[model samples]
Target chain A: MKMKYYSEAHEWIMIKDNEATIGISEYAAEELGDITYVELPIEEDDVTVGDTIGVIESVKAASDVYSPIGGTVTEVNAELEDNPGLINESAEKEGWICKLANIDVAEIGDMMTPDAYVKYLKSLD
Target chain B: MSDLEIKNTPLAECHKLAGAKMVDFSGWNMPVQYSDGILAEHKHTREKVGLFDICHMGEFRISGKAALEALDTIFARPVFNQRVGLCRYNFLLNKAGKVMDDLIVYRLAEEDFFIVVNAGTRAADSEMIQSQLPEDVVFEDVSDLTAKLDLQGPLAADILAKAGLKIADLPNYFNWTEAVINDIPVLLSRTGYTGELGFELYFDADKAADMWNYLLSFDGIKPIGLGARDTLRLECGYALYGHELTEDYTPLDAGYAPMLKLDDFPEREFTGKAALKALPVENKLIAITLEGRRAARAGADVLDASGTKIGIVTSGAFAPSLGAAIAMAYIESGKSLDIGDEVQLSAGRSTITGKISDLPFYKEGTVRKKL
Candidate 1:
């Protein structure tokens, strides 16, 4: 009933019963070094695929986080407001940025599998 | 520049082996951060000890009968009165009163001197200094053969003693001595970019990797990359070459007018003296503390209370030691702003608010501590 996929932009989306949680991939987080701030997307905002949902600020530079699947943001991780280092600690597991409801499952099929994403990271180097 | 054109220091292979994340810094293949990350490295340097690879910096030797008088005419600071074993922060300026480079001048002897400059401006600095010197002065670039390393923190002295250097024999602040560390002859200087009590060692290029591993072998010392180095210097309100001290601005704009000694020594004349006397300072460099962890990076606009742009940020970062964000900006001299004045910085999609503070957002540095 749960599935995970990764986008070419290095974002990960976990879908379960029409609701999806999103976060950046481990490779992306490692590249960011020490994350200082996370401008979380607002709840109740409608987002489309490939839209810039939020921003991630690291000690080095600022990076835009894009939405992988279109839906309405139902919840945001408020813990990141005070402790943004969570993303650097465990980007994929405990650092989920937001949860979106009514996501189109068809868009999830276009994402790469876990094994494929690992291969994709290899090709980057 | 292309990847093939990027130069490497002597310790590049050692850094790669230590899992450092390398980046291209000023055309040099340098390590920006190690596996422990920038924030951790910064904290470690403040609380413990850290080592840095600084071989890319340029050093020059100028010795002759007129070397002292020749240098006194070239720099904005007085060089003739400088005593042997003392180092002074000096500046080179163009005729139009623009800063060419900020360097350290060491009075090695009455006629012999050592100059250390930034890596990016080495060629230009050499050309400018060589052309201005007298025919009798001998100028030589000794950068390629020199390996530089900085052991910085409160425990730096203790670590040096552990490595076979006598703590009592170490030079005082802003002084240099020819000492032996672990049977290696080095020119050890009691100064560092970080506002910490530290020593910078200069030796043969072949001893880079060995010295790096030797110093870091201590329990208190860790290998820190340039990422933390930038943050540490910024927090201390030190002016970086390309950032706070650029060719587009003069020393007055960077709040270094007092160091120029224009009024203190009326008889002294140096390059750009007339231009500096004629030029009126248009900007005042100020420090600001951000409201939160977000940084106001360089090139970001600083706004007054009514949303009018008043200044531009030159350097910024979330200072790990302070637990808040800090930045240095040059505001219009015409603007009447005081310390603790509220200002806004436009960063990304957010307009973050901050308050103007004094230089050195982080205090309690051990740099001036008597050994």
Candidate 2:
């Protein structure tokens, strides 16, 4: 079964088999106001567990999207280059930012589950 | 203002009732956007009508037999010949000619004038203006009793008519007239910072909430927040106080020397006239459009084609009306950065490459539309 995990920084990663997909959480997207630009990571680039993989610019402010776990960027959502609103629309699904290869299954344990993430979001309030 | 206390506008409760996102803006609790969000509010203002709560802004009154003469000596621009009922954009400067605040002076009558200034700079501006006026000129801070609202867009007049708020006819652009909105006396001015055909309403603070609801009762009137306000003004290249205008830079440094007639007539004298004439343009404000959809916000680094650090961005945002990223920067003089010259804006880690462009990036604005 596929499993989704979240980071305290508001990034979400969905793991299925050997491939993992990453995107910003809905809470992060809403908090960013209106998404204007998304600096997608280059394919075939290596990333650390907490490295800032790319940048996101909203109408009100800008922030960095960090990778939840270290892996190689297999592919990036090229559609976001023209329509960053996808992050605001379906942040957890079609708005998946990038794909990671050579997944670190053990690191997924360190991330928060869906239920824990929801509670964490409330705590922020 | 201390973090322990946040000031609330007269319509703050009404804003919450409409589900607006409240933010601490310059210590005042203000709405950044309503339920429809920034994009929708911004687009509606362009294609339809939008209402803005501007109660946090400050207002002052100066009147006496010698009001004109005293005001002429105090203001950077000559205000003696300004006709009654007309409003003029002016600059209040310190001894060094730097802009203390940019304001609009409304000649309410022969010896009566009303001034509007930025909300954050109200206190200092009031003191500085009071210091310059002659003892005979009566000066009063009307900010506490006054509240401001803006009805802006192409269909602003239609919205007013729909709500049955008639003023015989809308005032001419840059002019104001005494009128009544929903039985509340208001000074209606045909001027706005959004570059849209709009009206600014000045009324009693106590009736602010009632007035807000009365306007929004119209079918197409949307409650816009400060977020869209920033984008709209930035697109028109209007200067924001902390951004394009500040105490450190003179009006000439900010590109208003020629418009203000700073050195045009060497014979005339005003506050800081000598310093203004002697000072050379330091960093010149120029408008630039980004090469892509990425917005280069304020505080970004501006570099020329050869990768020289020439200036820093004062204001930047994605122009909702034009569907492009636009910015204003103070490029240091002597670099000769001409229009159409390519430059790079270091916005965080990524760079937004763009060319020097003219102001009012969104030209379709209806600010000058004749009724």
Candidate 3:
């Protein structure tokens, strides 16, 4: 399924039947350079919109991954522990970091569509 | 920012064209990594070969009758006994035994010497060397006129051999030879920070682009950036200037006490020897390996099993070679931590368990192989 929304923090989320799967965008992974370690949030942890839920470290720098929607984390990708580069290979698909079952539908209003994200990236340059 | 404020290397535009991640490092716009990614570049350096643009490092030339005698007193390492083709690692020290900078001294001749220093401490190192030199010594900061490149890995020798230089003819470890690569006068040294068989080439800054492009034409060579350069070095347990070895830490306290020759060289004759001998070493640098993939980075707190704050991490990263996280830290001396001592590092809400191991984190390196 196509990514339904993107956050300014570089996270992309796909809405599927009221639930959402979230991961950092390919652009963010490319900028991070090398994924060394990831501090994923625990399952069932309550997260607010725009709150830092995890950390991603590259060889050069470290960045926080923010929750794009208010929800409780239902599942986390344990495969990232041994193979963090999956985020670089398939950021929006297989590399999704976590899944939230009860995401707020109104949170989509604060996110950007694919077209707007492309424009946002250009504005950065 | 104006162009006059900082200098750009010949490969600056090339880096931009390749979509490199740029960062302001020591007043230079350096590429931290290219599109291939830092971990891939680091693994390539270990398995095949990797090329690095190390032009940011500083170079200086000292020539005169007093140059030898002046350096003998200025640096911690011995200079008089060094042969013309050899190089020695030495430290520039402050009055209170703190390390100003760690440098490599290339003895060109009895009266001529070349000093390679860190990029961040170039200005201060130059001033310190000049001020300590006798009036007869002639010192020139040749950093602007020179550029350095490091070709490192198991295949480095084969790559250089294809470039028309017999790798065997080059000097052994810590030795250098002045040669011509592509008709550009270059100095090739059998030295590098990565724990691999490598060569460091120094040539005219203007010809850096030609040399860089020439090397990239090889089949297995790729342009690795500063990000990989850091991981490769960190895995080798080499002391980085700002992280492990700094103006505030002495070489002795930075796990180089055995390398120091205070008794043989005599402290009274050296620049900072008196203070170094008088000051008691408070902390000792140690290596730690985490139990899992979670890394504890610089400034992270190191604690014992009982939750006592034992030290602070100086440099830390995930080792691609070992598939584990490793770090270096300075802890209080006289507290014995064996090879398998249990330790924990706290990074915000998460804590990582690790064990004390003697450096380097990765063994089987080809850095000191016999020619």
**Candidate 1: tens digits of C-alpha lDDT, residues B87-177:** 9999989988888999999999999999999999998999999999999999999999999999899999999889887888999999999
Predicted candidate 2 versus true structure: per-residue lDDT over B328-365, tens digit per residue: 99888777877898999998766779999987788899
Flag the better candidate by DockQ, 1 or 2. 1
By summed lDDT, the worst window of 10 consecutive residues in model 2 chain B runs over B160-169
Ranking by lDDT, best first? 1, 2, 3
How high a TM-score does candidate 1 get?
Answer: 0.98
- Tell me the tens digit of each residue's lDDT in model 3 across A62-108: 78899999898999999987788888888888888998888778878
* lDDT, each prediction: 0.92, 0.89, 0.87
Please report, as a residue range, the 10-residue window in candidate 1 chain B with the lowest summed lDDT: B1-10
Q: Positional deviation of A109 in candidate 3, in angstroms?
A: 3.9
Give lDDT tens digits, candidate 3, residues B97-149.
78999999999988999999998899899988898988889999999899999
Clashes of each: 0, 0, 0
Ten-residue stretch with the least lDDT total in model 3 chain B: B1-10
TM-score of chain A of each: 0.97, 0.97, 0.94
> How does residue B28 of candidate 1 score in lDDT?
89
Give me the candidate number with maximum lDDT. 1
Candidate 1 docking classification: high
